[model samples]
Target: MKIEVTHPEPKPGEPVGAQYWRSLDEYADRPEFKEWMHREFPQGASELDGVNRRHFLKIMAASFAVAGVGLTGCRRPESYILPFSKQPEGSIPGLPVYFSSSMPDGWDNLPLVVETHQHRPTHLEGNPLYQPYGSGLTAQASASVLDLYDPDRMTSSYRGTRRITSAQVRDLLQETADKFAPTRGQGLRFW
Candidate 1:
């Protein structure tokens, strides 16, 4: 069935982003509005109409699917626990560990270090040996340690598949470098 829609034009001198709506009684009395409302949403004596049932079923199915996903995610997986094979020399089991490092954000580079405890980065401090900002840490530099240890960073690295070992990656890189050495101007150079 063909549906017709009618909207009143804005009057002159009316402000922008302003809308005009007629009263329910006036809208019901208008033939064009009545036809439009009937075509868009058909009212029934009871709630068990075909169109209403289809819409209700679609909503219920979506809600059930979301609930099922939530329920499945509620159980913790065994692989979430990661224990270190060997702890570092200066690292304590539950204490924070700090290391000096240089971080460049945009054109400016800052020399700072952070203290991380139990996999969560807790605090940040400026490097004493740095020239310009010696032993003084900014708020942004301090907060950057939290960003480094964010859960989103872990999720991005380990989203779909298991991680590969660094040794396996280094061996693959060495093999590829050997194969491409000839093409990289070692003996294949024109001049």
Candidate 2:
């Protein structure tokens, strides 16, 4: 549950580097490093200068007992189970079915081969019918499916200080277009 605050967020597909160590023997390939790597652990790890096997086991058992009691006192998570009244004749539960589809991209439509599970679209890929004989999908087309389930995407429009419906936004845009009709946008500059 603890986080290392100093580590930066990694890029999406970047490979991680090896772990850093303080000792030079650990860094360079050394006999001591190999010995440490093959060290017999847990068997004698708890048997330090004072603590013996039985003493360690007793401490561990007590710790586990306390932990188990503490966990039981905490609230158990709630789970839900919903069963369908009737199953479909041909369709099998939990099996995915693929459907050919396409999404608009400017003037063109990118083909999609979507995987649907129990009538729900689960994943998608570029239609194998197009490009390099269905070799791969463009990054834009591949990433577009994520937009379908995006929770943070804007669902409404706002005008100035007030929330406005989509229709009102369209009307306002039209009114502005009319006002700027003959001017050819000479007075306004888009940043």
Candidate 3:
């Protein structure tokens, strides 16, 4: 049931000044507000409709039964943490390996020194040896290494909603190139 509350109005000759009021009901001293404040909770706050003790017990019993079955069924997947039989040629177990590389931009490349731990690229820095583009990397180049390990990075090409293999993609590109070969890609649009 919706409770109707009315605002208190000032008398005609009463002085109306800036007053700090917490709530309209408290400021107006309404009977409904007084009744609500006297109770620990608002009406029906602690009530559950149509959920008796028997129904609640049945739900709890079913939940426990399902949980017991799940717990019994679950076993840790078989896995072995084996050390490498032969260490990589130039790798030391604890030492990070650095490789000089370049990040391709449109018409230019950003020289980079990539640091890897266990063959995974962990960090990237400017290639100090490259004289022309000094030992300084752009922000994009610095953070580009993250893309290598990104879990959501696309690993396969897709045509609409269907996944297509690399070989199929290559063949399709070749066929398109052959189709545009006579015109020398005159009608081709990159976008």
Error of model 3, residue 119, in angstroms: 0.5
lDDT of each: 0.71, 0.76, 0.87
Clashes of each: 0, 0, 0
Q: lDDT by residue for model 1 over 17-81, one digit each (tens)?
A: 84556777454578876765666655554456456777988999999999998996786766765
**Please, what are the lDDT tens digits per residue for candidate 3 over residues 33-141?**
9898888588977565789878989999999999998998899999997768997899877889999988776657888899999899999998999998788888887
Candidate 1 local Cα displacement, residue 88, angstroms: 3.0
TM-score of each: 0.36, 0.37, 0.44
lDDT of 1 at 142: 76
Off by over 4 Å in 2: 1-78, 85-91, 118-120, 130-135, 156-191
Clashing pairs in 3: none
lDDT of 2 by residue, 1-191 (tens): 99878878898878778778877877896986777667746346635778877898999999999999898688878998765688766567778888888777665667789987777776878887787537366678777777867999867787676889988988987887888888976675322
Note each model's CA RMSD in angstroms: 14.9, 19.7, 12.4
Which runs in model 3 stand beyond 4 Å of their true positions?
1-81, 158-162, 166-191
Model 1: CA > 4 A from native: 1-85, 149-154, 157-191
Better candidate by lDDT, 1 or 2: 2
